[model samples]
Target chain A: MSIFVDENTKVIVQGLTGGQGKFHGLRNRDYGTKIVGGVTPGKGGTDVDGIPVFNTVKEAVEATGATASFVSVPPKFAADAIMEAAAGGIKFIVCITEGIPAHDEAIVFNRLVEEFPGVRLLGPNCPGIISPGKCNIGITSGDIALAGGPVGIVSRSGTLTYQALHELSQQGIGQTTCVGIGGDPVPGTNFIDCLAAFEADPETKAVMMIGEIGGSEEERAAEWIKHNMTKPVVSYVAGVTAPPGRKMGHAGAIISGSKGTAQAKMDALREAGVHVCLNPTEAGQKMVEIVKAL
Target chain B: MDLFEYQGKQYFSRFGIAVSPGDVADTVEEAVAVAERVGYPVVVKAQVKVGGRGKAGGVKLADNIDEVRLHAGNILGLDIKGHVVHRLWIERSSDIAKEYYASFTLDRPNKMHLGMLSAQGGVEIEVVAEENPDAIAFLSIDPVRGLDLGTARRWVADAELDEVAREQTAELLVKLYDCYTTGDCDLAEINPLILTPDNKVHALDAKVTLDENASFRHPEWEEFRATETEDPREKMAKEKGLNYIGLDGTVGIIANGAGLAMSTLDVVNQVGGSAANFLDIGGGANADVMASALEVINSDPKVKVIFVNIFGGITRVDEVAKGVLEALKRVTISSPIVLRLDGTNAVEGRAILAPHLNEKLITEPTMLDAARRAVAFANA
Candidate 1:
């Protein structure tokens, strides 16, 4: 019933032998995600938490029938891992590695589009995606999210995603899925892509989108919402008071030449009939209100 | 990660792109020496990362040694749009028969490599794109396919570049694309890719932005880091592996993720308090990470109150609580800390902090409550 993942989705972890891979792989498995196997180039034939390991993603997919992959490799190898996942025919790839060079991402992204047209790459520096209760493929805590709710959440941040999920879950508002698209300048999926999916998902009654200052992605998403979206979407844009030309933690969370500012993003969203919240808690409350009215 | 004009020219030269031989100098004497070596008439250019250096008189053509000294003396230590120039690039000036523009940068929306080539070069490309849109030829290069000589030639012709400059320009464009990709640069731009009267094509000015994320792949980038004049706080945070940005405020804030860290800053302001800095401890909320973050925040004298906002997901609040307590023991903080613990193992986390609750160490039940308390303490 979620947008990208559900109960039927079988998962494989790339770089499963690495510390981060093993940690999150076990967590995802515990969250009821179908983590069938893993792929570690040199550490194939080993097992991580009873999960089988293979040398290549193709082998993992062949043996476990895995449809999705979690990329947990180091920054230098993350782009290649994504390419391998796509080449192996993984339908959905969620990369959790941060600090990947933009040029590497640019090459991998172009490859995914030209070669693996059907493959969906989530992030190179993101926390990944979570379909609550059914499957969890990212680093997002499964315990915080409620399953099969009327709300769908998409954000460009990690902890803020958790914050919104906590606020909603505290109010007994469950969600269908929550996606952290990552805060990289050239992330694999953007707000518009996630919003489009949310609009099509019948289970998603209302959507909550969290954005930060950077690029024109938010403004572009606002345009998409104005022209296309039918569901009520509540939103929040962080870094409202951020100083220009300074990067605020995230690589993409910067104001460049007055092009990407919180004020401009908020104005665009409001003009598109989207209720914008000032803070994370208020954003959750706005979503709750919209869902109740719906 | 932005390179100076001199460094950019050096990088371009590595890719076989023709650039006027240049050398950087810090003094008027050094500038004169460089001008003598390069054989004046030289261009005395201030080394600053910002644009409009030419308009600000940071760029001057010096025909003789006296002019070189005069220009370098003025350009060095000269403030151009708030960026003080501490170095100068002296190079042999080129004779420009025509000016063209070429650059390679990532197009985020399309997830592709964008290339802009225009016949109208000396002026800002933005002006060209806005005023005479068709004067610039825009091409989306497939990162995998890359730019070949044939495509470059067609692109040059499409931009309406002079017929004499086509072949060499196309060849140079391909090389520029190589430098853009192989050099691990976010942007490799030649604002004025000029054609001299002799039909020789060369880069007149170079602007490059290195991809900091790609530093691991290029070891030589250490040189770039050496030249960087980073803020002392930023340098210290980088050394400790903490994502920290120093700001001018009273409340010092630390959180586990970038989004939450930023939201913490926003909420702090929303509660009528300003944050002295933004620090993201990432997923590591252990004693070491917490202590390091605290040390960096403590170094900032403007901070009056510290806010520790930890919303655990995969990061356990109990672990963060223990880290906070352990960090408190390690560092003598000058300000009071307001801690907000929520999410996974929040109860256990709060229980761990129960014994440490005091006038200086306070824990709130919610983010809003925590922000309010921190702001109150900051103002008080």
Candidate 2:
């Protein structure tokens, strides 16, 4: 009962001939994702070690009947690739390209909402999703994730997502799906979207969310959970000591005028009956405790 | 990136939005020159990005050449919140019949552009929101359809601006929306969108934040790049293409991603230590990237120990281990290094680092263990 993708989900790579695209695409394929096709505009008809490459997403989707897309194009062209996927009727998209202009993301995100209401885009700078042994997408290492467990994970940061997965795997707990919504100012998917999905899934008994400073998304998620969530949720918000106005690496990870502080986010989550941890290590332990009681 | 007042005005003007006539001056003499050209009864405003500049005496109205020289001399070389005023924006002062607030920013939750307008201006919007929430009228505009004049007119009327000021404010708001969207701005604000006695509406102040991600399309933004006063360590890291932010601490930290790097800082503080900087190698932790990061950290004299934390996802642990070794070979460090490598191919990565373990180089089993060791080294 995994969400988004399972063993049967057919996936295609947008820039499958490029270095990151080819490497991670084959990794996803080798991890048992039914990678049906690949797309490279000029390199259409060519193949990457047998995965068919087409010039457009429309051709790949039609020929392979692929429902999901992994956009690995560079930042400048990433928005176009995502729109192309939407145009071709791909339902779920995971964009792993980082450094995309925020304005492009805003336009593309709204376009998806107005024009392609059915399309779900994950990230422009995310680690992708993995439903344990069932399916793996994006760049998340398939080794650290265990299959078919009670926990569902979501995060904004890539390595923290890996760190959380590693922590959970070490605790001998598996997950239903681990979604990285990316750490961009304007991501296609957010914590709320993933949270709602996790809540609706019967297999996910508990949820663990990893958030950081910048934006009101985490605060909004807290409000939503207070009203809607039934299962126990444990969370971690990074950048506790981050100074104001300083961007801590990721583009969206900045503390702005009195809002988007780690303290504010943590307080909101705690108020929502979430077991907010002080650190990632503590978050894993808290999740383990919740799962044990469950 | 936050634009200086003068730069924001220039950006606003590009989108056909009306703003106070202004010019940036680097020196007091230059300020006087700009004020003379812009005309008397001019305002000399500090170009620092920080707020409270007006309270800090960084803003002054001068009616004549003597007052201009006096105000410019005082404002120049003044420190407002640690930002030394290296420049000033001299503008011709405008008569304010009424003050209003207007801005366009992304509403993250709704995934649309949010426009906030209030008849109550020159004060923080939060104060307006808390004091009289109804005083501010909110408009959500889809980036696709954008804002129209009719919508802007209704929005201004809803915001309860003076009847005389509504039409001009509406027109300017539409232009401001253009500046926000087409100008590639994360935030385009005109705090105190002044309505003059003549019923002319113009931005008295500008608070614009350019989306740095949009730099690829707008090569003209290269001009803003020259205005930054960056920390030397951060400047060095930026050149090497590593995600780095300089901090004041003893433990030098390097991690694989932004979140982990920040978490590393938290863990270090929890273990009774502080991080000197935040450095994210960001998936491509090759020899060159690692060596540059190491060099940047080593340049910080406060750093006593280095902590390299990598949890491989697409980044292979073995590749990271080799990169650390290669980086060590390239940059001679005065401080000990604590390494914690995990995730994909971790066993191979551990084996690769085994031969290099010594007094100067150490490996811990977990993130907490590595943080403790690094903190201990710093205290030692």
Which one wins on DockQ? 2
Candidate 2 docks at the CAPRI level of medium
Categorize the docking of model 1: medium
Per-residue C-alpha lDDT of model 2 across residues B323-376, encoded as one tens digit per residue: 989988889999999999989888999999999899999999899999999999
Q: For model 2, what is the C-alpha lDDT against the true structure? A: 0.91
- Candidate 2 TM-score versus the reference: 0.96
Q: What TM-score goes with each of the models? A: 0.95, 0.96
> What ranges in model 2 sit over 4 Å off?
A292-294
Superposed model 1: Cα runs more than 4 Å off = B55-57
**A53-170: candidate 2 lDDT, tens digit per residue:** 9999999999999999999999899989999999998999999998897778888998998899989999989989999887888999899998878999999998999999989999
Query: Which 10 consecutive positions of candidate 2 chain A have the poorest summed lDDT?
Result: A98-107
